[model samples]
Target: MKYLVMVQGSQADYDALGGKASAHSPAWSEKELRAMSSFMEELNNDLAESGEMVDGNGLAAPAATRLVGLGEDGRPVITDGPYGETKELLAGYWVLDCESLERVTEIAERVLRAPAPEGSPVYPVVIRPIPDAGGGDV
Candidate 1:
């Protein structure tokens, strides 16, 4: 089976950091940044060696995103994001081909353990099964 492991982040959290660029900006000491990078690289290596990792990548900041909707005149209207009441944005994702949702959940939990800012709260991870060609969850 295949699933998308979503790493989510709250908009309030982003705003608290001043904005998108500043959120991932070099405000952190170089040592902190290097440690985070090394931790992720090691994690990704483990996943790859286990043959569970299909693909994974981080997304650009929300401020760089846009919301598209129809205007009153029936034209496409594009607005910058940091969108509505929903607080979370997808910070990153990993596609894993695994035997069960249980395994995927375990992987998600492990991802949550990756290095992050000190004092940061644990964030949510969404696990959704990918559809197979027959239009069913894989």
Candidate 2:
């Protein structure tokens, strides 16, 4: 089965855990950023070895997001960025091929416990299975 592991954090929480300013005014430290990248590489390597890694990447912050919606006239309206009221937003994601939901959960736990950039709080990680698109079997 395929699964998408989403990394999430609140804007306030993210700002509170500052490092180097990204496109945003504040960001994580270089050392911490390197650590995160290294951790991700290691995790990807492990998943590859296990034949479970499909693809993955670290994403840009949500402040740089763009939203598209329909205007009252039914024409497309492009917004500057996210407008959700929820505190938490998706930061990144990993696609995995796992044997079972239990296995996916295990991977999620490992990701959450992975080291963070110095001075930053651990962000929340969620694991969700990707539903089959109803195509014919591979």
Candidate 3:
């Protein structure tokens, strides 16, 4: 089965990684960022070697996000992200094809082990199964 494992974050988290502090998170140091990157890279490498990784990437800052949807009149509307009421946004994701739910669950837990700055805000790692092309949930 294929699973999408997503990491959540807030604008504060992005700002901190960019070396700016916010009320919700502290600035991250170069060393801290390097540690986090190394951890993620190692995990990706392991998944690739095991032939379980389909795709994965760390997303750009929330400031680069755009919200696109249809208006009440059925016209398209677009807006910048970190929308006023949304405290969290998707920070990254991994698509993994694994043999069992337990294996995927283990991978999600490893994502939680990624390093971060001392005062960084911790968000969730969400897991959702992808539906097969024939249309039912996988």
Candidate 4:
């Protein structure tokens, strides 16, 4: 089965980088940033070796995002992100082809160990099955 594991962030986290395009900037101290980067690299490599990883990437900040949807009369509507009243922004995601939901959840728990600023609260990781093209959930 294929599952998507998502990491959430806050608007302030993006703002700390000054702009959405500066998403890769070191928002934490050098030590912390390096540790987090190393952890992610190791994790990705392990997943690859295990033949579980499909694709993964850190996304640009929410400020650089655009929301597109159908408006009344089926017209296209567009809006910028940093969406009002949103408590968390999607920071990154990993798509994994794993054996079970429990296994994916375990991987997400490991992701929770990713570094964060001291005193920061534990962020939620969303784990959901990716639906298949035949109109069935994978």
Candidate 5:
């Protein structure tokens, strides 16, 4: 089965994540930064070797996002960025092809253990099996 693991972050705490630049920013000390990078690389390599990794990517900062909506008058309302509650922003995600939900859970546990800067709160990840949208057993 294929599963998509969403890395979710609360909008209220989004700004505290140092914004999107932190994804590639050198905000942490050299030692800490290096450790994080190494850890991520090792994790990717391990996943690739295990053949469970289908695709994954980190997202840009929310500030860079744009939202489009329609007003009650049927006029197109353009927004600068994500709308609604920031608490529901999807930070990033991974699509994994696993044999069972148990396997996906195992992978998620390992990912949750990944290194983050000190004092940063751990983000909760949502794991859901991807339903086959084709005309199959619904």
Candidate 6:
């Protein structure tokens, strides 16, 4: 079975990583950022070696996000993110092919252990199962 594991953050988190401080989070120092990044790389590499990692990627900052919807007249209307700095957003995700939900839960536990700056707030990693071609849940 396949699972989608998500990492959540806020615009303030991204800003901090880029050396910008906000009311929500402090600016991340170079050393802190390096450690965080290295941890992620190592985790991905381990998952890849285990053949459970199917796909994964980090998303761009909230500033670059766009929202598209249909206008009252049925035309597409696009707008910038306009997201609050403290609003939770998707920071990244990993797709893992695992033997059981327990395995995915274990992976999520490991993801939660990723390095972060001291006193940084932690968010729970979200996980959802991917259904097979049939409409039934796998």
Query: Tens digit of lDDT per residue, candidate 6, span 86-123?
Result: 47888899999999999999999998888877767799
Candidate 4 has a TM-score of: 0.82
Please, what is the whole-model Cα lDDT of each candidate in the order they appear? 0.76, 0.74, 0.89, 0.82, 0.71, 0.89
How accurate locally is residue 45 in candidate 5, as Cα lDDT from 0 to 100?
81
Q: List where candidate 4 sits over 4 angstroms from the true fold.
A: 17-27, 71-74, 134-138
Q: Model 6 misses residue 85 by how many Å?
A: 9.1
User: Residue-pair clashes per candidate, as listed?
Assistant: 0, 4, 0, 0, 2, 0
Each model's TM-score? 0.79, 0.76, 0.93, 0.82, 0.77, 0.93
The residue pairs in collision within model 4 are none
Model 6: colliding residue pairs = none
Error of 4 at 10 (Å): 1.8
lDDT of 4 by residue, 29-107 (tens): 6676678789999999999999999999999978788999999989999999878688787899999999999999999
Candidate RMSDs in Å, in order, are 3.8, 4.4, 1.4, 4.2, 4.3, 1.7
Candidate 6: worst 10 consecutive residues by lDDT?
81-90
Error of 3 at 10 (Å): 1.2
**True-vs-predicted CA distance for residue 13, candidate 5, Å:** 7.0
TM-score of 1: 0.79
- What tens digits encode model 3's per-residue C-alpha lDDT throughout 15-75? 8988999889989999999999899999999999999999999898888899999999999
Kindly report which residue stretches of model 6 are placed more than 4 angstroms away from their true locations once superposed. Answer: none
Candidate 5 off by > 4 Å? 10-27, 82-84, 135-138
For TM-score, candidate 5 versus 6, the one ahead is 6
lDDT of 5 by residue, 32-126 (tens): 55776687678778878999888988787566678888999999887875555554578778898899989899888987887766566577779
